[model samples]
Target: MIDIRLGGARPESAQGCVAVPVPAADGGAPVAITPGLLPDDVAAEAAAYLAETEHKGAAGSVQSLPRPLRQPSKLLLVGVGAGDEAGWRTAGAALARAAVREAELTVLAPAELTDAALRGLAEGLWLASYRFAMIEPKADAAPKLAQVTVAVAATPEREAALAAARTVSDLTRFARDLTNTPSQLKTPAWFVEQVLARTGARVTATVRDQDQLAAEGFGGILAVGGGSAQPPRLLQLSWAPEGATRHVVLVGKGITFDTGGIDIKPTEAMQLMRKDMGAAATVCATILAAAELDLPVRVTVLAPLAENMVSGSSWRSGDVVTHYGGLTSEVHSTDAEGRVVLADAMAYAVARLEPDLLLDLATLTGASRVALGKKTAAVFSDNEELVAGIGTAAAQAGELVWRLPLADEYVKDVAAEIADLNNAAGNPGAITAALYLREFAGPLRDRWLHVDMSAPSWSGGTDGELVKGATGWGVRTLVRWLQGLAA
Candidate 1:
């Protein structure tokens, strides 16, 4: 994990590389220096370098000056285009990549660093510093920057803002780590253990194994996991503080590994199936962060973990399984098993938890990726107010979420001849999948929101705050939403 701290010290006095922001001017090169906290000589040299090189200070651009730059080991001139929050985030990420080899770094906060800008900067640095070295071995080279100090004027509000930023960065990295781990090592049982270990004394966690799930009539989970040697698990994590006013239940689709069951996917499609559990990771990280922050709200998370493999016992197409709420689903395509497990969890959350608001996240359909591209997650809900709230929260957190309508006409696509729903809906698959999960939401259908995160769960390459893989897309949005409820 990357160590981040908030300090009142000026950037020029700090050791290691110091990132200085250069705000873009009207048309010519950048002329404004943020913070203006650098030493006189260092500041003059940076201005001269920019003028001599004609560095425009475009967003995401970096200009580096090696040693002999006054006091610091190096000077990094980062571009903050238009001096907006988004530009600051891009500048922070660019600084992180430029200072990859440095062991310690400091970023001078803009003189007017709003709470939003502070959050963006913190998120960028911590997110860009993430690297998964679990399975692959790394070279025995010099260590990357382990500590990052955001130099700002110390005050209660700034300190609180810094704390919030650190919390988001840490938990987002936690979710990323879970999503990046190899499926072989991160089984259903392993996921449960991780939840317990990371959330000790913060949240109450309980796990229901195969026998328990079967006894409880969780047909969706059982049928999906029956194909694999490792049985399924329904893990519940709860955080209920005294005087909590509202209850929110989050359901995550936790397919540890998907081989597409009897209907195996092509080799190219199955290669990244280890990240099928990205939704589970997001929910777990969100609830744990809420508990750590001691938010005054009751929160519960239901994660259905399974491994969809090809075997004699694998549930095949045309089979009908009765979900927890007595809604039967016809398995039209074995590859569409995420909605099946999620159905069971959603049903359980609605029937038992009776939450005021219910939200389920899943990487359930590739159609979502096709429709919304790779950066945005598709959100479906019948309630306009809930959707608006989600949109607001997502915007505030800098997470991209587009509200896809839940048209009643789309429900016909998932209608089964012999069952209440079908796993595979023909066209507009993402919308139909949400309709399928809506069946389990039952009486509280209007209170439910489904997030189809097929695309944003994993990144093809580095982008802004996203690292190479496991983007951890939904954690910040969920956290912000929950925080608003508490507020």
Candidate 2:
């Protein structure tokens, strides 16, 4: 974790090292040195260093020459393009990478920068510093860099800024843990137990057996999980602060594994089925982080956990099921299990919590992934202002999200012949999934946003940029947005 602060001093000044704060692009003060002053050394010996700092085709080199009148053994400058905030963040990240490799005792981020820019630098550096080298065979150890010092020159506020950066780093790592855990280890039952273990929050868990599900009319859960030996469960976790300004409901799809049921996916596609619970992992982490942070806004987290498998018992296509909210759904594809379970979960949230805002996250569709790719998640909602606010928060959090259209007329595509709706609407699967959930969202629809995170929910071979297998994608963005709401 990185310790951030605001002050007027050089990072190396305290311990005999030096850092230069460069001016912003808009120009106020040449706050510090802008990486352009160092001589470029591009050679084979520096190949490893170049690999660590290069970005988007930019040449990364090391400057070995001791600048005239400099006391340090070597003077290094990381090139951040003139006044570009994005460039600054990249430069900060690159500097951290090089510093860690060379095992420097302390590195600095010059203060006299805006909160947003400082935070961006902190985030990039911290994220880049994360190492998931656990999976590989052990190598000869190198001396570790024990500390990072960000020089806060002329800025009086130091404590709060440092605390905020630490908070962001902690929450993100927590989310990564949930996503990284295997499905067998993170089952519905296990999820409840973990939440209870955390303490300091209200938790209610209900596991509906065959008879109980039938009696309560939660056809969505039963139909989706009937094939699996593990039955389905619905868990609700809440945290309320005294005199909370508003209540928010968060619904997460918790499919332990998705075999695509009868539709069945290729073996390669099924390899990472354990990651199907990515959305649930995000929600669980969010609620826990909120409780830990003691945020003043009341929050309720709802998770509908199940596994979609293959068996004679699995609900087949054309099956009609009645959900917990009394709405009927026709299953057109067993692979579309995400929307089915989420429909009931959303309904349960609105009916019980009646929150001022409603939000749900899931690895719901491949279409969404194709549309937005791994760098950004796609957001669909009926509420424009809420969408804008979320976008702002996403930018600040350093996570990317693009608002998509609800397309009111597309609502008709989900209409069912025998039920209130069809879980699989055949066209624009992701949008249809959001629409199905909206039907049961009730009054919360006006204050809702549906996030389809179908890509990068789980990393491939190795973890990169602060994520192992599970990226913990939404925690920071949601937390930042909630903070704004509280303000």
Q: Please report, as a residue range, the 10-residue window in candidate 1 with the lowest summed lDDT.
A: 134-143
lDDT digits (tens) for residues 327-418 of candidate 1: 89988999999999999998888888979999999998999889999989999998888888888888877788998878889878888899
TM-score of each: 0.95, 0.82
Model 1: pairs clashing at backbone N, Cα or C within 3 Å: none
**Model 1, stretches more than 4 Å misplaced?**
11-16, 27-30, 67-69, 135-142
The lDDT of each candidate is: 0.86, 0.69
